[model samples]
Target: MESGPAIFAGTTFALFGAGLLLWTGARVLHREPVALGVRPSVSLISATLSGVVFLALGVWCFGRM
Candidate 1:
């Protein structure tokens, strides 16, 4: 049988990644720093890089399915 749960998880991850990228871009335009809640120190570069990583992970999941 086809894996329904995997498809849902993949879609959720992909959407989260896309939203993170958009949020990071907005912060960049407004000259604000971003944080992932793991540390007190926020940086624009880290936020942008994280967005890319999440996006790549989502794409990879989709490819696996």
Candidate 2:
């Protein structure tokens, strides 16, 4: 069984992941602002990639449960 710290860490990771996923979804729905540091396509691609990474991390953390 996992210890308290591991579980806590996992929850944290999952929360961050969920937040990123929400942002991506909102962006997709055009309810959120687009990325602004670079070209439009590049910003979008980076945001998408980041969202994927966050989601993966969250799932991995949740798996620890």
Candidate 3:
């Protein structure tokens, strides 16, 4: 069985990643602001990638458990 902390961490990571992806998609599609001191396209791509990484990490954690 997984420890409580591990489960909590995995859940948090997954939820944050999902939320980030949704927010990024909504902002990009709606032409809303997404500032990161870089071009909009670059920011969008980076944010999307980060979300993917977080989601992958969360999955990895759960798999380990």
* Number of the top TM-score candidate: 3
Q: State the lDDT of candidate 3 residue by residue for 1-65, as single tens digits.
A: 55677788888889989999999999988998666578998888889999998888888778777
The best-first sequence of candidates by lDDT reads 3, 1, 2
Least accurate 10 contiguous residues by lDDT in model 3: 1-10
**lDDT of candidate 3 vs native?**
0.85
Winner of 1 and 2 under lDDT: 1
lDDT top scorer: 3
Q: How do all models score by TM-score?
A: 0.72, 0.63, 0.87
Candidate number with the higher TM-score (1 or 2): 1
Relative to the true structure, candidate 3 reaches a TM of 0.87
Weakest ten-residue segment in model 2 by summed lDDT: 31-40
Off by over 4 Å in 2: 31-33, 62-65
Residue pairs with colliding backbones in model 2 are none
